[model samples]
Target: MTLPTSTLDLYWLPEAVEFSTAVTALRAAAAKGADGNADAGAAAGTARMLANQRLDFLQTRTLDRAVQGLPDAAWGAELTLAVLGTGTLEHLLPAIRVAGLRRGLRVRCWQAPYGQWRQQILDPAADLHRQRPDVILLAVDPAELLPDLPLSATAEEADTALAARAEEMVGLWRTARERTGAVILQQLMPLAEPPAFGHFERLVPAAPGALAARLDEALVRAAARERVLLLDLGRSLAEIGRRSVGDARLWHHAKQAISPAAAPWYGEQVGRVLASLRGLSRKVLVLDLDNTLWGGVIGDDGLGGIVLGQGSAAGEAFVAFQRHLRQLSRRGVILAVSSKNSPAVAEAVFREHPDMVLTRSDIAAFEANWEDKPAALRRIARDLELGIDSLVFFDDNPVERDLMRRSLPAVAVPEVPDAPELYGQTLADAGYFEPVAFTADDAGRTRQYQANAERRQGQAAATDMDSFLRDLDMVLAVEPVTPVTLARVTQLINKTNQFNLTTRRYTEPEVRDLRDSPDVLTFAARLKDRFGDNGIIAVVIGRRVEDGRTLDLDSWLMSCRVLGRGVEQALLSVVAASAARRGVERLVGHYRPTARNGMVRDFYPGLGFTALPASAEDQGWSLDLRTAVLPQPRHFTLALSV
Candidate 1:
C-alpha cells in the first residue's frame, strides 16, 4: 500500500518480484474459480493487479498472453483494433493488448505487412478489407509524410505542403472509415527531431522541425473537422522525452520510428483513447475531506484553524488541488465529496470559507458519514444514478485507498501521493476523465446534477409518484438528430448503460450519417423540469427493415439520473407517431441484455409491445402500428421538432 513519492519506483510495478508466481496462480485460479467457485474473483483481482502495473515489455506480453484468450465474460467490451503505420508496429502490439486489459477491454489487433499501410487501406484485396475493425489507428510517422523542405523555402511553401499532406491523410481516413465502418484515430507526429536550428528553430519556416510542427497542427485541425480521435503521441513523447523514447541506432538500422523501450508509455497513451471511445472513461471524482482536500480534519480543527486556501505552502497546495477539481467540474467531470466527518461540519467549510475554490454547489453528491469507504462510495454512485464503476476514489490514507482498490476493482483508485503538494499532479496523471468530445451538456453538468437533486427532493415531498411528476412542470423536447445535437447524441450512445437497449455504440461520423439518412428515425430527447434542465438525457434510433412494414428499434438508452421521470413514455410516444406517419405498420423493439443494462430488461413488454420470437435470451417485441393506440405523454409537455 506504499504510495509512490518519487521516480525511483518507475522501473517496476507494485510487487514486481512475485509477478511470475502471481501469473501462475492467476492461471490456476481462473480455471478453479469457474465452477461456481471464488477462484474467478481471485483471478480477476490478480488480473487487475497485474494489468495496472508499469511493466517491462516482456511482462506486458506475459499478461496479454494470459488474458487474450479468456471468454468475453471476463472483459467489459470487445473490439478489433487495426494498427497501421510506416514504422515497426509489431513491437507496439503487446503494449496495446496489455493496455486494453488494464482498461477492461479485450482488444484484438491486426497489422498490415511491414509498411504496406497504404495498399492495405486502398486495395480491397488486402487483409484489412477481410477484417471488421471497430477502431483503426493510423500510426503514420511524420518522417514518412512530412517533406524535406530546404531551409530557404518561404512560409507559404510550408503552408502549401502542410495542406496537401493533411488532405492526403484525411482522404485515407475517409476511405478507411468507409471500408471498415470503424472509428478513425490519427496519431500526431512526435517531436522526435532535436532542433537542427537549435535556438533558431522557431525562426526557420522551411526547417525539418518547422514542417513537422506545421504538420502536427494541420493534423489536429483535420482530426477535429473529420471527427477523428487524435492520439497526441507528441504530448506523451514530450513528457517522456524523446531522448528516452527515441533510439538513433534502431532508426538507422531499421525504419523503427519509435523504439521498443517506449512501448509501455506508448501503450498507455493509445489505451486511454481506445477505452474512452467505448464510454469506459470515469465520470465522477470523489474526494476525501480530512487530510486529502485540506491540511486537517474540519470536525476537529475547525474552519478557521484548518490549513487551506492562501498563505502557507500546505494551504496553497490544497487550494491548487481544489482549483484543479473546479476546472474538471467546468469541463463536465462530476465532483463529489465523501468524508468521515459530520455532514454539517464538513459542509460548513465549503459554505463559509472565504478561500474555498469548490463551493458546495459544485459537488453533485456529498456523502459525509462514519460508514466504511466502500459503502460510502456505493451510496455516492447511487445518489448520482451512476454505476459503481463510474466513480473514482481519491483519499490520502494509503489503507483506505488499498481497501477501495481491493473491494471495487471496477472503480479507479489511483496511486496517490503522500504529500499535499503532489495531490493535483497525481490525480491529473491518472487520466481518469480522459474526454474525446465536449458537448453543451458537459459544460453544464454540475447544474444538471444539482437540478436532479432538487427533483429527487421534490419526489420525496410529494404524496405519490404521479402527484410528484405532475407537481414538477417537465418539458420533454424531442428533436431530430441534427448537427447541433450530434455530439451529445453520440456521447449518450456510448456512455449510457442502465436503460440502454441493444447497447450499440456509434462514432460521431456514423451518427452524422444517421442524422442525414432518410431511412433512420433518430430522436435526441432533452428534459427540463421546474428546477433546471437535464441536458440531452436519452437517445433512440429506429431503422427501417427489409420488411418495410416495421421500424426496428436499433438502440434505446438514457441517463440513469432521469430514469423515473417518465422521459421514456414521451419519447416512445413520439417515435410511435413518427413511425406511423412514415406508413410503417409495426415497430420492433429489442432488448439485448448486457451486464450493466439489466435494469431495462422488460422495457418493451412494459410498454405494450407483443412478444416476438427471440434468440439466446434476447427478447424481441413488436407493436402493431395499425391497431396500437400509444399513450400520450401525461407528465410533461412534449415538443416534437423532428
Candidate 2:
C-alpha cells in the first residue's frame, strides 16, 4: 500500500477554505488507503496533522452550516456546553467543535452575548438557566475582573482589590451552580502583561504580578470548596509562548482577548478537561521494556550495562521518562508492562537493578513473555479488569507500534519520538490521563487493583465458589448517601460500565438532586475482605412509585473489581429489606442494554425476579417484597447505617 506522499501536504493546503470543503478534505484524507498496507503509525500521525490544519482553518473562516454539518449519532458522547466569558467568543465555537470531534464528542456550544457574563450568571431566568447546559466554561479576562488595580496602588490596596475580585468570582460560580447545576470549568486569569513596577513587583505584595498570583491562590481555595475545576490557561500560554498566543490588534478591534491562531490550542485544552469530566479519561499506561524503559534490550544487556540513570545523556532521558510515569502512577493511573522478553530477565531488572526508578512494586501487573504485544496488552487489561480501550500503549519500535495500532485500534498507540529525551514531553503533550478531580479513592487505586490480583490468586486456589468466598472474610457496609461520599458515588455512576443494569450517566449536581429528592432513595456500598478495602464500589438508587407501594430501582451498578464477591446479592438483600420496612409491596427493576453492559443481561433473572416483556433493548422485572426471600451470602457479614 502507498503512504501519503508527505505529511506536510495538508499544511500546504490553502489557508482560507469553506468549512464544508475543509471537512471533506479531512474525511477523504482519513479514509484514504482503507484497504491498503500503509504503516498504521504513519497514517495516524498524518491524520492528526491534517485534523489540526482543518481546525485552524475553520476557526478563521466562518461556516453558515457549521452545526448542521456535524457528524450525527456516531460520537461516543454528547455535551451541551455554555460558554460565558467577558471577551468575544464567536470564533471559539468552530475550534471547540473540532476539538470535541477529535475526542469523540458531539459538542453543541451556546455562547452568551459579549460582556453579559454577569447578567447571564446572576439572573435566574437567563438563557443559561433555561438551556441547562451540562458544562459551563467561565473564561473571564483578568483586566475585566480587576480593572481598578493600577500601578500606583499600594500593596495593601492591591491585596484588598484582589480579595474582592476573588469573592465576586466565587459568588458568581456558586450562583451559577445554584441556578443551572452544571459542572463549572473556570479559566484562571492569565497575566497578559508584566507588572508596571518591574523588579519591584517581586518585592511588593501589591504589584500586579503579585496580586495576580494572590488571586490565583484564592481561586484554588475557592474551587476546592465548591469542587470547581480550574483550567490552567496560564500554563497553557507559557507552554505555547505568551507572545504567540496573544493578539493586541484583535483585542482592540473585536474584543477578542486571545489570538485566533491560538484558538485551536485553547480548544484542545478545553477538550481534555471536558473529556476528563465525561469519564472518557484513560486509565492505564502499558509500556515496553526494550529501548522504551532503557537504552537496550534487557535480555542482551545486563542490568548493570543498560542505560537508565544519570551517568550518560541517553540514560538520564530514560530516567526522566520513568520519573514522569511514576508521577502519573501516584495520581491513580495504573502502570503495566507488556514487554517481549524473558520473564525472569525482566523481573530481575525491576527487582535487582539499583538504578531503576520504577520497581516491581510500582507495577500493578507485569507481563514479560515473548508473546505478541497486542495479546500481552489484552491480558494486562483483563488482569486489571479494565476495558482495552482505556489502555495507552507506548513502544519505541515502529513495527511493534504499527502492529498494535492495526490490531487494537481502540487502544491509544502514541508515536514515541526517536530521541529518548523527548519521550516524557511527548507523553505529557498527549493529555490522555487528564483528571477532573483527584479524590482519596484515586490515590489508592493502584493498591486496590493490586489487592484484586491477590484476591484472584486466592480464588484460583479455593476448591469451590463457596469456599473461596468464605475464606475471604468479607464484610459489606451499606450506608446512606452523605456529603463526603457524594463525589465518589457520582464518579461510579458515570464510570461504571459492566454489571450496570441501566447504564445511566449522571453529573455531580444531578446526583445531588437524586440524593436530596424526597421520593428517591440513594445509598452506596463499601466492601472489605481478607484481601483489602474496595472503597465505595457499588451504588443504588430507588424511587418510590405507586404512592409509595413499590420501590422502583432507578439505577444499580457495581464496580467490576467486586463483581464475583457476592456484593450484588448483598446489595439486593438490603434494598429488599428497606423496601419491606417502608411498607412497599413489590420491587421493580429495569434493565437497559448497552454495548458494554451485556454481562448483566441475566442479572435480575438470576436473582429470581420475574421478567416482563418490554422493548427489544430493555427488560422489566418485578419481585414481591412480602414473599420474596432475600438472598443472603453466608460468607459476608453485612451492616446497615441508621
Candidate 3:
C-alpha cells in the first residue's frame, strides 16, 4: 500500500509542531525509502506523529495552567461553579471538569439531564455522599429532549406527568443532599432560533404562542420547589439569537477540530455559562463609576453634562444597563461602587440624573478617590465586611481591569464587551447573578444600606452604648424553622463560616429530617430596624438528649450584615429561652475552628459557657440553664411567638 502524504497545515502550533511536523517527518521517512525494512518509513512517521501530537497537547495544557494562575482578585476568593446539564452531557462533561480543577469551591457541580427529566441525573447524585460536589448544575435543555419522554394524551395529563416527574427528581436531589451541603444550580434555556436543534420549536408542543413562557414558568417553579439556584441565561440568549449547528452561527465544534481563534470564542461561550453558574454565590458586585455605569468621565463631564439617559444612544445603553443592575440589586445582589473620581461629582450625577436607574441609596458602599481601582476594591470589601473573593469587579478601563486581574487574581473580571450597546446583553449572558426568588427583603436592600449609613452616622452622636441601641428602633423576630425561612436557614447553615459556632453545615434534607425528628430543634432569626429588614439572617440547630432535659447547640450562625447590631445576642437569648421553655436544664455551646472562622474562635467562651476539658481542642462548652443570664437587651423590641 502507498503511504499517506503529509498535507497537514495548522495555525497556532505550540513550541513543537504537532500534526504538520509529524506528517512532514513521516513524508521524509517515506522519501528515504527503507528498502530492507518495509515498515521502517511507516514506523518513523507514526513516531513523528505521536511526538507532534504530544507537543500540541502540551500547548493547550499551558493555557489551563495560565487560567489556574489567575489571581483571586480576578474571580473572587474561590471558584463556585454551578454546572447545568444542557442534556449536552457529551459536550459539558469535559468543560465542567476543566472548570473544577484546582478552583477553590465550596460545593461542586449539579448535573440534570432533560431525557430522564432529572431521573438520569439523580441516580448518580444519590450516591454522591462520598464525592459531594459544592454545587449542582442542572444545565439540561428540557425544550430539546423532554418531548421524547412519555407524554400524557391530554394536555392536563401531560402537565401532571411533567410536574410529577420534576417533583420526583427534585425530591431525589433533596434526599441526596447532606446537612448544610451542596447548592443546586439550574440554568434556564437560552433562546435559539430554528435551523439548529430547534429547541424553541419544541418548547411547548401543547401550546404554540406560550411555549417559551410555559417552559420558563416550569423552570421557575421547579427551581423554587427544589430550592435550586436559577441563572437567567435564557433572558440574555433570547435577546441575542442562540447559535446552533443548523444555522452555522457558531462553529464551535468545527473550530475545536481546526484552529485556536475559533477556540477562544467557543471556549468563552462555555466559560460564560460556567462563570454565571459559579458566580451565583458571589457576595459582592463591585463596579467602577466612570465610563462603566455612566458615560463620560465625571470630572470632565461636570456631573450635570454627563450623558446617562434616553436622549443619546450611549446614554440610553447605560440607562438600560443600570436597570439590569437594579434588577440584580432587587434580587439580593450587593452593589458597591469603586470609582477614581471626586465623590462630589459622582454623588451629583446620582442626585441630578432624572433618568438614572441607580441612586446613592442603592449602593452598599462608595469608594470615590484617586486610589487605584484594585486598592479601592479591597477597601470596599473590607468596609462591607465581605471577602475579596466574593467580589465581581466591573470597570471600563482595560489597564485597570488587567491590573486587578493580575494582582488580586481572585475577583471575577469578565472581559468587557466591545460595544456599549451590548453591555447588558453580555453581562446577562455571562450568568454571574442568578437568584431563585426576589423576596420583599431583597427589594429593600438599598433601603437597608441607607439605614446602615444613617446608623453609622448616628454613632458619633451617641454618648453611650445603651442610648445608641435604643435610638435605632431594632426589631428582632425569633421563630421555629418554618417553611418561609427554611431556605434561608439552610443557606446559612451551608455558607456562613466566620460567625458559625461549631461550623456545622446542614443540608435541606437534614434540616427537614431534624424538623420531623423529636430530638432536634432548629430556629431562625429575622431582624429589622429603623434602617430596614434583613429577612431570616440567622440560624441555629440544636439536639435534645436525656428526655428533653438537655440541649446541645449543634449549629449556630448569623449573617455578618447584622453582626455588630446585637442580632447574635438576641438569637442566642431566644434559643436559650426556647430551650428553657422546653424543660431543658442545660445548654451546650460548640465551637470548631476553621481557616476562615478564626473570628469565632472564642465564641463559646465569650458567651459565658464553661469550657469542657474532655478533648485537647476546645471542642465543647456548657452553661447551666438555671444560672445562665438571659441577655434580653431592652434596645431590641423582642417578641417571641413560636
Candidate 4:
C-alpha cells in the first residue's frame, strides 16, 4: 500500500475523508498492512471503517470481520474493561477491542447487566464481584443519576441536585474501588437535548443542557479529587460531528446514548487512555531536520536560505509546530532530533534561527549527523537510554518514514501532512503522548533527561566508573510510599522496564494498598547528583512470605537513566536496612524474563543472591539478610525517612 504524505486531508484522519475509500486497500492486506493479522493495526483501521457509515449492523459486521481477534498473549499488557452503563454496549464492543491493539493492549470488554448499574455495584453477588477488573467504565446519563428541575427552580436547587449526584458517584466509585480494586472511570453525560433556549440555554441553570454542562464540570472536579478517570464522550462525539453526538430516536429505539456510527472514535479514545495507564504511551518525539522542521534543506539553503519564521506562511507553520513540541516538552514529553544532515549545519539552525520556538535546551538529545535516518534514530534512543519503541518519528519525507517503519517496526511513525501547518495537529491527533495524569515527576522529565545527558558526558571524561561516580557525589533519599508519593512511585512501577526485575505493574489503589498493608514494605527512591535531581527514579515493593521471616520481593524497577551509576546498589542498601528493621531475615527475589527486561536477568546475582532452581524460565533467588553483608555505599550517602 502507498503511504500518505502528498495527501493528508483525504487520508489517515478518519473524520476528514470518505470512510469506504480510506480502507479499500487497507482491507486487502492485514489490519496494519502486515499479514492481515487482526492483532496488528486493526485499532487504527476500525475507526476509519466505522466513520461516516450510518448502518450500525454494517459497522458491527465490518468491524467484527476486520478485527478477527487479538490473542491475550499478543500484547504486553491485558485488561478487562468492564463497562457498566444504562444504555446499549454490544455494538461498541468490537470497535473497542480492535482499537486497543493500537497501544499493544488486548482489551476484553464485559457489559454489565442492563439498567442494573446500581444493583451491579451494591450487590456482592453481581458478576463484577467474581474477580478484580483492571478498569471499570461507568457510562450513565445525568438524568439517571440526578433529578430534573423545573425552569422556575432556583440555582440553589440545581446545585443541591448536582451535589447529591456527585455524592452518589463518589459512593459508587469508592464501593467499586474497595470491592474490585479497579481503576474507575466515570464517563460524563452527553448534552444531547436540543437547545431549549438557544443562546440563553446556558443561563438557565435548570435547563437540561445547562444541567448536563454543570454535571460534566462537577464530575471532573469529583473524579479528580477521587482519583477517577473521566471519559468525555460528549467532547469525543462532538468532534466527530453534531449528529454523531446522539440521536434521540436511536435512544428511544435501542437506548443508545451515543450513536453507533461513532463507536470507532469512542474506542480509539478509550484505548489511548487505557494504554497510557499501562505505560505503552510514547515518550520521545524524534523529529527530522530538513523539510520536517523547516521548509528547506539546511546544507544548500544555509541559515539564511531556509524558509522559517514570520515573514512567510510556511515559516510560521514551522514555528507553530516547534511551539507545539516545546509545549509537549513542558508537559514532560522528551524531545530529540534525528536527522541525516551535517552536524554543524543542522545544529546551526537550532542555535541561530530566530524563528525557532524550540531552543537547544528544550531538546534532551540532539542527533544531527551524516548517518542514515534509521541509524540516527537508534542513536537518539540510545542517547536517551529509552527503548526504540518509546519514540515517535515525524519526518516530512515519505521514503524516510517508510524506511524507518520497515526497519524499526516498534517505533511509531506518523504520516506527516503535505502542508507544514498541519504538522502539529497531525502529530497531536496521532496520540503518542497520552498521559493518565500529569505528576511532578512528569513535569521534570525533560530536565532530568537533559541532566542525564550531562552525566553521560562526565562518565566518558572520567578514568573509571568508580571515580566518575565518586566525583559526582550522588545522594539517594529513601522514603516510605505514601499517597503524597503514590503517583510517582506507581508510575515508576508501571513505566520502568529495562532495569526492572519481575516487571509487575500496579494501579494507584494497589500502591496505596501496599502502603497500608502491615506485612508489606515499599520504598520510593529519589537520586540527586552534582548536576540535577532525578525525581523518584526507583521503586521497590516487598511482601512478607508465608514463612514469616522471609520477605518476597514483589517488584523492583529503576529508571534506565540512573542505571550503571551505583544507584541500584545504593537503593538496595536502603532496602536491606529497611528489611532488617522489619525482622525480615531472608529476601527472596524472582527474575521473570520479558522482551524489554532482559538486562535485569542477573540483577539478583550481581547483588550476591544465591540462585535457586526453578521449574520454569522464571528463576528464584534468595539472599541471607542476616549473614550476607550488603554492599556498603562507597559512591553515595543515603537518607531515610523516619
Please state every model's RMSD to the true fold in angstroms.
28.3, 28.8, 27.2, 28.3
Model 1: colliding residue pairs: 33-40
Candidate that beats the other on lDDT, 2 or 3, i.e. the better one: 2
Taken over the whole model, the C-alpha lDDT of each candidate is 0.76, 0.72, 0.60, 0.72
Candidate 3 weakest lDDT stretch, 10 residues:
192-201
What number of backbone clashes does candidate 4 have, counting pairs of residues 3 or more apart or in separate chains? 1
Query: Candidate 3 residues 480-582, lDDT tens each?
Result: 7864355556767888777787777678778888877888887877776653345567878889987888898888887755554567777778888888998
lDDT of 4 by residue, 529-618 (tens): 664355677888889986669989989888765655667887788888888887889999999988898888889999999989885658
TM-score of each: 0.36, 0.35, 0.32, 0.35
Superposed by TM-score, candidate 1 places the C-alpha of residue 260 at a distance from the truth, in angstroms, of: 33
lDDT of 3: 0.60
lDDT (10s digit) by residue, model 1, range 395-513: 98889999998998888998777788887767655677776665556645445434433343323223334655785679898888765466567877878777898999999899989
**Candidate 3 residue spans exceeding 4 A from truth:** 1-464, 616-618
Per-prediction backbone clash count: 1, 0, 42, 1
Candidates 1 and 3 compared: the better one by lDDT is: 1
* Model 3 CA RMSD to the hidden true structure, in angstroms: 27.2
In terms of lDDT, the best-performing candidate is: 1
What residue pairs clash in candidate 4, if any at all?
A: 30-36
**Tens-digit lDDT track of model 2 for 152-198:** 34567566667766877787888888888899999986765423222
| Candidate 2 wrongly placed segments (more than 4 Å) | 1-240, 445-642
